[model samples]
Target: MSTTPHPPRHEPEPGAPRDLVGVGIGPFNLSLAALAHPIPGLDTVFYEQRPRFDWHPGLLIDGTRLQVPFLADLVTLADPTSPWTFLNYLKTRDRLFPFYFAERFHIQRAEYDAYCRWVSENLPRLRFRHRVDAVRWNPGRNLFEVDHTRLGPDGEARATGRTHTRAVVLGIGTEPHVPDPLRPLVDAPDVPALHAADYLTHRDTLLAAGHVTVVGSGQSGAEVLLDLLRHRPPGRERLHWIGRTPAFAPMEYSKLGLEHFTPDYTRYFHALPEPVRDRLLAAQWQLHKGIGADTLAAVHDELYRRTLHGGWPDAHLVPGVRVRTAGRNGGRIELHLEHVQQGTRSRLTTDAVVLATGYRQRPLDRILADLDPHLRRDSRGRPRIDARHRLVLDPAISATGCAVHVQNAETHTHGVGAPDLGLAAWRSASILNTLTGREVYRLPGRTAFTTFGLDQLHPHPHPCPQTPPARHPRELTPLADGT
Candidate 1:
């Protein structure tokens, strides 16, 4: 036997054009990298500005579990036998037996983060601390140029480089959002107000405050409130939870309800009229934004337990309330609130505030600005994303066999599952299939039992209209469904 080491397959030399270049190293892109590793002829690289892989580090509170099952990992849904599966990570750590005995379907968020970090450490061609600056399509070269900055350990730019690729995938994730009324306070370092994304960082300061107010009724808000409740004294707990929602509703997690995250639903959603899609997205907030039933139950049980002494805890949980404005009052925060139903207004004075207003998709225009002129948009001025997750670009770019794909940025076109973990593997698989121009990962023909539309009663792909109705620049094109 010859004793020789083989070079990595499809490993491009420095400055050589690559098959794919991924902009962000989030879980979605990590999934794509893992699935692509087994392929023989695909040269892929992923970049992330962070020093290492971390998924919601501040919100990974103790006892908080993932909403999805363990099967919704980086590669299991697409290829269970892949060595990068979460189960394989457990096996490598000699914890598979313990995990099996524990019978945990949903793992803790911290554990999931550790698992992803493990994968990031082991995976090849994943460049951390590298920030992608811009992406431009070089028509003459028939390649996309990716400019990136390599940062030092302290996050200062140390070096700059560029790479050329046939295609690019962007997985730039969401950022924490603060309501306009509370943005000024959150931005002030002196004020104790902050978004829940930084909860753990300022947790001790928040607990030390005499009064703490959590704004929002979503899962993060509930989780923060529950954590605060558990730490504070029951009788002296000065807490307030307020939001615009009517009530702290439980998330829609029924068996049939989850089918909306399936690929079948994604295709159905993509084929709908643009106006209908927008309305559906607005109406389906509860599907993804509501609190988990168990989390809500724990909150209520904690509150109820404190009431055993015949006096209610000094915690106020109010809904249907909106914060009209906020300001500082003698080192304390004052929130001007309004009750929507009663048309009543009130003032709340608290020492600290936690804005759990959730996150919004990071805009792609910054990186893709160079190619913006060649990109097509929908009636709402958003990029037109096809069913396969590729941005619909001008023929000048597409004719050259170059494409720009997106992950987690297609909620409007792909439905709420765009940011969902359960759909991560499937979406990665779909993108891979499209990029390779072959059925690399044979996906399921039917993933949901519920037929989304009258025309979709039979399990077959629907034919999307090639051209939309003509309309003026400021008007909407009417559809048959009257959207």
Candidate 2:
């Protein structure tokens, strides 16, 4: 690994170029960095716009636990022996024994965030507070040129530099999404409407309000509502929770249902017809979007506790309702809502609104505009990602041995596991294996017992032994010499 300090611009040595230039320092890319750290000859660097690592800071409420098990950490799933594992972090903090005695399968969200921070701080190759401005293919040098601006304490641009590398992996992550109907209220400076992403910052003010409404059915919404309910008085607990789904559903936690997040299922989903993939994603929202069973129970218990006082608390839980429009009343917010089932309209006035509407994939078109002509697209204009997670590009770029890889942005192509924490280590290993042209982490041949398709079981009978077996365009294949 190499570090270029304070130079006006970074210039790669005549014979040495970075093996990979990671564009974002989120958990996925951080996993790649940790795995690549011990490799003898692989040179890599990661950049992040923030000065430090923090995952969903505002949503890391007290007692909120991660959906995945602790084993799904940065390096555990792919390489349990790595020093960057969560167990190692606990040992360094002198809490290993306590953790073992706790008998906890799932850790708290704040602890997970802190574990990632420890990894980021110890990793030498990470360049934080540097915003990547542009990425372009340099035909003459046969490499990708990455431009970035170094930021100071106040986030001002202190300097600018460039790095040339053989490959690029984008782990830009996602941003909180606010629905269109309620955008105006959130945009208004005087209004207290905000997204759940900023819940912690405004929690006190929200709790003090006359009425608070949470608008989503996911885990975040449940957590926020539960927190508010616990702090308010019994009879005066004026809270409303609404969502578009018919009922507050528990996530699919059955043993077989989790196979959807395995490597085999990812491969199967990638090979299906594009339209079929689209429809399946729309229908399988509960797989990754529903609230966890434990969280649902907690919410119920909190509400149930409030009812033991002899009178029902001033709380309303409604589903199958959508916010049509929102405006400001004298000192409160007015929301126009529609019932999806009855097609009836109603209005509700609240002091504040929390839009827990979830997040969308951050678009890559802006940063990849220079490479637009070389990118291959699907019918819906989405980038066509191959089984190896590399964006399918035109022959002109592919032939040059440079690939553009994406992380946490392939739900459309890789199924519901795209943004899952459990798949982070495996995905990073796969990308590293492809970049180094060798079996870096030695991934499992089969991760699930369920056969995704019958054709996979019986590729061909004795009818035509000599004929070649059919292969999907997106099927993963080992690259020769990691070129």
Candidate 3:
């Protein structure tokens, strides 16, 4: 390993068991850390393998904005007064007045990334460059053992450490998902095919290509196509955008329709039978998978602008098409495609391909392998996450009061809101409340005007207790003022 010294480390006291230990330091876990900071005695820490925080660095296009509003920041939705809010970051940076004048409800992606980085830099109880290797319930000690490796600047393991905690949270987040048919092309270094996750890294090479193909109709694909169309000459813009959907649909953004992302919906979804939940997930793609209306309009406007000169642009935007297979055609790429509705097959040759196919939850088996035997899986063999976000473990593990929770890894148990930023603060607060076994965050009684199910006619709102029960030594520290 290189001799470069590691950055400053923030770790819990040695030999003493912590109340909570978070496995991954993504936005979800970062939110948890921020919410846990003000509490006086909740000893907790988070770990991330990355050297620092970066939220979709490659897709931080110059003008792209977050899908949610600015209030849905790391801590604002949960506790607006928290010093770690996005507005606080702006105030500290001396940009609050300018932000007010800008009248922007949704901020740019880069600004959001900067806000998160500021939180990561100043937030206590965070350990970057620490890769968690395994998690197991140490029955002898009645605690969970978290084995992690501290890495040098170059990502080489420099030291190994074990942390003992009463509870563990896994927030490893997602990974880019490439379709099987196109995986070979994307994996081969010789081919120019790449996932949209690395769009900016090889953007110049793509712009120089004679022709480019974007293979997904989601928001990312739309953004990439719009960027390319704006850069290329009008009427000569040779681009192709295709997906399996019947049409490039806009996201469900109606006031009431958006309630699908509410906590009520999550509870209702969890109560659903496994098969019903699977079917609902399949039919609710537009709720979370479609392109944003503004993005769709921008694409249309750009294409329309190019046609004003009397000649149509040489761009083809097709749907209901899927790539059956892809291969290297000499120096170029050849894609074998089939149209489901039309029952037709064709071949297209392109100089470059951008797979905008989205992401999937990073599997937890690798890190939780040791605890697999204790985990209670669903009919589909996925971990069974309860309504409180805790993994349903064996009676032996539960009897010890040791719990394992997950973030952004419970769509099947929760709902589409599982991966949404708007729900991050709520989920984090919920996890904290569950871990402490008392109402620490004081969650909202009702978040949506629409009742998710008929059974909730008079939903008994179990808002966290105004005053936490007389705190036991093992209980967590509740927010004092109950703000």
List the candidates' TM-scores in order: 0.93, 0.92, 0.93
Please give the distance, in angstroms, between residue 29's alpha carbon in candidate 3 and its true position after superposition.
0.6
lDDT of model number 2:
0.89
Report the Cα lDDT for residue 31, model 2.
Answer: 93
Candidate 1 residue lDDT tens string, 55-110 = 99999999999989999999999999888889888988889899999999999999
| Number of the top-ranking candidate, with TM-score as the measure | 1
| 129-168 per-residue lDDT for model 3 (tens digits) | 9999999888889899999999999999999999999999
Angstrom error at residue 85, model 3: 0.8
- Over 4 Å off in model 3, which ranges? 1-12, 459-483
Model 2: how far residue 122 lies from native, Å: 0.3
- Residue-wise lDDT of candidate 2 within 1-483, one digit each (tens)? 122111113444654778899999999999999888877667788999999998999999999999999999999889998888999889888899999999999999999999999888888789999999888999888899999899998999999988899999999999999888999998899999999999999999998999999999988999998899988988999999999999999999998999999998999899899999999999999999899999889888988887896888899999999999999999899999999999999999999999999999899988899988888999989999999999998887788879989999999999999999999999999999999988789787667768797445643345444544444434445568985
Q: Which pairs clash in model 3?
A: none
Give per-residue lDDT, candidate 2, residue 228: 90
The candidate 2 region of ten consecutive residues with least summed lDDT is 1-10
Candidate 1: Cα lDDT at 113? 96
| Order of quality (TM-score) | 1, 3, 2
